[model samples]
Structures are given as structure tokens and as C-alpha cells.
Target: MTSLPPALLRPLLCTVVLSTPLLANAQEQRPGVQAGITFGATTGAYAHYDDKPLVLPALSWQGKRFFASPGSLGMNLYKADGLRLSAVATPYTLRFKTDDVNDPQLRRLHSRQMSAMVGINADYSADWGAVAASVKREVSGHGGGVESSLHYSYPIQAGRFTWVPRVGVVHSSARLLDYYYGISDEEALRSGLAAYKPGSATSPSLQIAVSTPLGTKWRATGVVANQWFGDAVEDSPMARRSSQTSAFISLMRAF
Candidate 1:
């Protein structure tokens, strides 16, 4: 019953799903920026508290062997042909909902605030698709949590539109799982829910993204994606749903 990441952070996952600064040519040894606004909605266990019609300003920069986004930053350590190895840092997904929702049950749960995850990434690109693997640990959470993923994507260009279809599997550590899905002993007593602690778990994901030319120096990107929580997460007392899904559209200007 965990939630999809926030709108601004959602694209960060897409980058992780592809494992790099996608859309832009990574091997070109160039520097560029894309800036604009992205509006989107995320639906899942936290849907009641999370904002809909999410509006976030988007900014991303990429160079020969480095890239930075609102939620992540990385530098490539090695590159040959289309293979890359890099180090990266990314933001975490929080579990706390605000007081705006009228559902008292949802609001009583504890909140897992945000953390910065840092680790390494490996990516390989081919004509058919790209494959990537990454492992990161929460630096500030101090829970020694580890998150990792293996992803594959295929990009197709038709007319001025480019479509990327992606699939992946993600593994989250016990610390990460417990932080988001488990109720503490204190919380269980206060909220009248049994305390539960979960170990590591894995989840599968799928997504499709499309980008098309809008006008000179501008283009549009839209994406929809979903993640089905693993049993460890789905079985939590705080969990009321099995999956999280999201969609977003953005207009960008390249510089």
C-alpha cells in the first residue's frame, strides 16, 4: 500500500528506469538543459493525501559524463561505446500524508520523511533497447536501507514522436520497507493497529513514455506507469491497496 513517488520525483524514477539521462544522447559529450513545467496525478494507497493535478517545475542538465535533475545527480566514471558506469544520488519517496484528507485512519499513521540515496549505476545502450542496474543506500535515514533495480527499455521513433516502453524489477531493503509500511509499537498503541515489521521485498513495474515536437526549442513529454507492491508491503495493516499508478505530461524547452 505504499505510494508512487511525487510528480517531480516521478521523472527521477523514469531516469532510473532507463538508468541515465534519457532523451538526450549520453555519449555525445555535450552539455544541455531542459526546463519547463510538468503536471500530473498519482493514484495509490497515499492517494487520499497526495496532491492531484501536481504542478512541478522541471529542470535537467546533462553533459559528457554527468547529469543533474531535481531529484538526482550523477557523474559517469567510465564509458566505452554505449556502456556507462556512474555514481549517483537520488531523493526518497515519503509516506506521510498531510492533514488535508478527512480520513482519520489514514492521517494517524506515522510518516517516513524523505532521504537522499547515494550509490552506483551501470547502463548499457543498444539499437533495440537499453539495460540498467543501480544500487543505492539511504544516506540520512541511517536505517542502512538499500534500493536496487534492473531495467530495460526500447525506444521507437515515428514521425516527430518518440515512444519508450520500459519494464523493470526493484528490490527494497527491510529498513526501507519498514520505514514506509510498518507500524511502530508506539504507533500501533496510539492508532489501534497492530505493529508489523517487514523484511526485504521486490516489485515489478511497467511504463510507457512519449515525446513529440511542440515547436522550435520546445517539446512535450507524457508518461504513465504503475507498480504493484510486493506481498510484504501489500500485507501491511496500513496498506489498503495492492498497486500504485501514475501519469504525467510536461512541456520542455531545450537550451
Candidate 2:
């Protein structure tokens, strides 16, 4: 796969860094827009890849029937009795450049490019917690495949801050996993690594987020997350660890 130029890659990296969804417990979902900046870092899952630092703009909007966030956009198709249905589009962020790898052999492999995903989402909210499920397909001509996820989150009030704990599972189709992690015959020959073909995989993830108001117009949020890879991804020669850890913080002002 051809690597994206630095000009395009930078913006995409920004999207990845700012992809964290806004905690519903943190603020009221009113018709408004927020914009600011975020600073964060990540210990990515790829072999020979160093920890990455992130700085990106934070932007989001919510309305009666429409919503937009850092890397995604959606419109509510149905909403009633605490249940909602929507159509959404987001970006797949498991992308890396050959030059980003430290190992010589890994650097010889082809780069993985990002793709856009489009699909539908169903969400239900209650006093106990919130549950959401979504199914998406790669729509950017990058080895088309489907991905799906289900998640649940509960929010707690701690003093002036709202804390949210979330758990989720994500499933990736064979084609999607192979596009990002598989070592092809040509790549294996060039890098001198054994060729690998991964099947579909499902991974689990956990996350905790906290948010508070900075002032009348400013708000701050921070998050920590961990994701465990399934056998299909962990067994890849390009995998560095069975799990990945990441964190981020943001400050935004409403307009």
C-alpha cells in the first residue's frame, strides 16, 4: 500500500488523537458547538513503533437531529423513549507508515493507509447505563470489509466531576484485519518474515473518562483506555504487544 504524504497524514493523525467521544455525563447535550485543543499520547500496538505524542484541535457539535465530532459525523434517524437510531461515518485509525517503524525488516514492509467507514448505529440510554451498537464498512477502496462494536457505559458523579467507565468489544472482518496486520507473500519475501494471513478477530476494550467545567464557557476532559488484542492480531509478526494503552486530555470552549 502506498503511504499517505506527510501533509495528509498529519491531519489524519489529528483525527485519530481526537477521536474520543464526548462523555454524555459530563455535559448536557444541547444544541451547540465546542472548539478547542487537545494534548495526548499513545503506546500503539504495532511492532517497532515508538510511543506517539498527540496535539490536535478538539471540535464537536450537537443538535436535535445531527451531530459531529473530531473524526465522525452522524444524523439521528429515529429518537424516542430513550432509544435512538443513526447513520454515521468515521475514519479507521489503524494506519502506519513504513518509515515509522524502527526495525529494518519491518520497515521494509508496505505501509498501511487509513480508510473511511460508514454505517448505522443504535443506542439506548437508561438510568442504569447506556448501550450502543454499530456496524460499519470500509468505504474508501481499502480492501473493503465490515467492522462492528457493542459498548456499555455508566456514569458517576464525583464532586464537581463526572466519571464514566466503559467496556466494549470490537469485531473486525478478515479482510480488514489482513489489510492492516497481515504479512503478504511479497512483503514476507522483501522483509524476510513469514507470510501471515489472519482471520476475523474480536477484541475487548475498557476505558475511564472524567470531565469537569473549567469556567462558564470552558470544559476539560481526560481519558485512559486499554485494549486487548485477539489471537488473530496478536499472532501477527507486526504486533508488538497483546494489548495497548492510551490516554488523552482536552479543553474546549462552547460557542
Candidate 3:
């Protein structure tokens, strides 16, 4: 049997459940709190990892300058025309506990803890598409690394459904990679795997999301995404594949 890491639950729940309200607010621009339940699952990319189930209650709030959503909380510092800037704090979730792995060797490795990340985000929307960029640094002493990303997305409307397709690339600092994917000398001896210290890496990803209104106050949304690992991450003994795929679906009602 595969063990479910407690650390994995919070991040997954926040990412899938709380994010629903943000999506709904973006489309409707309504000002109030939204609440709902979400259910989803993910197939991890790590070696000997099993599918993890996600079920949780979610809450989101958007105000004139402050906003709270799944995985993040921020205050808008600048907004005009089609450009907006914000200072945000979020949880960094690319980590795992040893018991979460099914492989005997991997189970001997030390666990990685989740951390808090503080960052700034800038987004611009135009008639053609939207672009978003962010730079965040781990501040909880878990990794003490920096991460940044750039993304582009375009939304299309088909009758009652809205489709959004996005492409993005994420850059992880060497410290982040090492903390999460690297094998220490002691770990190598215990797990009988070669020691590895990886450098910085860049990963690219693609996603498609669809949403429709279920009623006047309710909305349903779904997302599918695939992210390819960088060479450094793919080389890790704990990694079984070159990419990871995840999906999420949720229904939310605004108050």
C-alpha cells in the first residue's frame, strides 16, 4: 500500500479548491466571498508514487485591494488599463515525505518539507490574450530558493462554455532543485543510490481549462495540465518519468 503524505494534502487542496473562486471572480468580477467543495486526483511523477485523491471545502474572497484565494493571498498595488501588479504570499508544495514513496530505496531518503513563498506578480490583459509573470522566494527556511515563471493564455467562448489554453515555463534555482531532488551523500549510502546535486532548471508546461455556468449563482470548472521536467529533475533517482499530469474539477457558488 502507498502512504499518503500529510504535506501533500494542503497544497493540493488549496490549489484545486480555493482556485475555483478566483476563476469565477475573474469571469464575473463580482465582489463577495465564494464557497464550495472540490474533488480531484493527481498522478504523481515520482518513482513508485500512486494517484492521490483530493477532496476539500474551499473559500475565496476578492476585495478592491486585497484578495485571498487557494494557495495564495495578496494585495493589489497597482491596477490600471489592462495591467495589474500585486504582492503575494503562497505555499510552496513541490515536496514529499519518505513514506509517500513505494520504492524501498526511495523510502530511505529524507523528506522534503513545504515552505512559504513571498513574491510579486504582474499581469496584463489585452484583446488577444493575457500574460502573467511572477518571482517568488522561499522564506520558510525549507529551501531558501527562488522561483519565477511566465505564462500566456487565451480564452475562447463557445456557447455556454469558456475554454482557456495556457503555456508557461518555470525557472527553479539551484538551491530549490537541490533541496527537493538532490541526493545527499548520507542518503546515497542509506538508499544505495548515487549522490546527486543538481543545478538550476527550467520546466515548461501546457494546460487547458474549461468552465460553464450551472445556474445564476453556481459555476463548474475543470482543468487539465501537463508539465515536462528539466534534465536536472529527470536525472534524479526519485523521478520515474520526464513529465507529470494533473487534473482538477470544482463547483462553486458566490454569495
Candidate 4:
């Protein structure tokens, strides 16, 4: 199959995932809007990627229970109460200013360009926490990949804080894994690094978070998560042994 550039990929995935909404109980509350900020850092075993802090603003709207956003847009349509359908688009691009170490074994990797992606999610839940399965497809630019994951979350009360735990597993197609992990023959020659082999991918993750009520209309949450990439996805040319362990605190307001 021919590969697509990252730029074209995002919209392609979005179009494919946005199907006719399965209308059942339109009991979903009227759509609302939300805006917030997130900040956190990640660490891993990869050579080209390492621990870095991310500070980004988040904006989203929920309509009849469906959600969309400018940074990562998505929607959810509920069916029969416990079952739901969803889709998401997430893209990140930034220039690396200096050489960074690829932990465990220190190797220098540099990135000059980046791209975006879109994913599809299917979910089922009870009254407590829910189970969600998702798959991401890279569409437009040179860097593209496919990812699938299963996640579960539940809430608990601790002190004055509302705590939640999240867990999941992720798998990726070769093209998807390689795009992010594959180092090309041309790239190897230019960088003076060995040729890279992009492999199939696997990852499992865990997260714990605490959410606290600030007042009647405002709230805050602190989160920490750990992700482990499988060997198939980790052995690829473009593969980084890097895992993501992150912590972030964010404040939210609802209307």
C-alpha cells in the first residue's frame, strides 16, 4: 500500500470515522464548551525521544453528549445507555533545538518537522467506570501510524479528592509503527546512524489521577500515567524504547 503524507492523513481519518450518528436516546444534554490547559513531562527508553515537558491549551465542546475540539477533535454518540461511539484527531509538530539523549543507551536524535493524526474509538461502560477501545490512523504527511488501545477507568474517594485509575493496551500496524519508529536508508546515511527496521507495535499503560472540586462551577485534576511499548513496536527502525510517564495538574470550568 502507498504511504500518505501527515498533512493529508488527519482529515482523511476524520472523514472515515465520522459516520451517521447512531440515534437512539437523544437524552444527551445540550452540547456545551470547555477550555483548559495541560502541563506534563514524559520519560522513555528511546534514543531519539526523551523526557520533555508539554504545556498546551485545550478547548472542547460537547453537543448532545458528542465532543469536538481544535487541538484534538472528537465526538461520542450514546446508544442504549451503556454503549457509545467516538472518534479523535490529534497532531503534534515542534522543532528540536538541541541534541537529546535517548535514555538507557544515550544516542542523539534530531527532529526538524512533524505532522498530525486521527483515531477511532469504540466504548462500553457501566454506571462506574467504562471500557474504551480506540484505533488511530495516520493520513497525510511522511510520518504516519495506526494505534489501537483498550482503556478502563473508575473513580474512588480519597480524603477530599476524587481519585481515578486508568489502564490500557495499545497495538500498531507496521506502517503506523514504522512511520514513528522507522529510520529510513536515506536518513541513516545522512545521520551516520545504522539503518532502522520498523516493526509491529504493542504497549500497555496505567494511570492514577485525583480530581478535586474547587467550587460550584470549577474543578481541578492531577494525573500520572505510565506506558510500556511492546517489542514489535519497539524494535522498528523508527522505534524508540521510550515509554511515557507523565504528571499533570489542570483546572476546569463547566457551564
Candidate 2: which pairs clash? none
Q: Where does candidate 4 have its weakest 10-residue lDDT segment?
A: 19-28
**Model 4 C-alpha lDDT per residue in residues 132-241, reported as the tens digit of each score:** 78777777775566667787877677887877777877777777655555566776766566667666767787877777777865666676767777876556444445
Q: Which stretches of candidate 1 lie over 4 Å from their true place?
A: 1-30, 47-51, 98-101
Give the Å error, residue 60, model 3: 1.3
Higher-ranked by TM-score: 3 or 4: 3
- Considering every candidate listed, which one attains the maximal TM-score? 2
- Per-candidate local distance difference test: 0.71, 0.82, 0.78, 0.55
lDDT of 2: 0.82
lDDT score of residue 167 within candidate 3: 90
TM-score of candidate 3 against the unseen true structure: 0.90
Q: In angstroms, give how far residue 128 of model 4 lies from its true place.
A: 5.9
Which candidate wins on lDDT? 2
- Best-to-worst TM-score order: 2, 3, 1, 4
Ranking by lDDT: 2, 3, 1, 4
CA lDDT, candidate 3, residue 198: 90
TM-score of 2: 0.91
Over 4 Å off in model 4, which ranges?
1-31, 44-55, 69-71, 92-113, 236-242
| 1-255: candidate 3 lDDT, tens digit per residue | 875466675446434532442343234345788777766765565687666577777667889999887667989999999999999998775656676677899999998776788999999999999998999999988769999999898989999999988899999999988888899999999999999999899999888888889988898878777789999899999787898776777777899
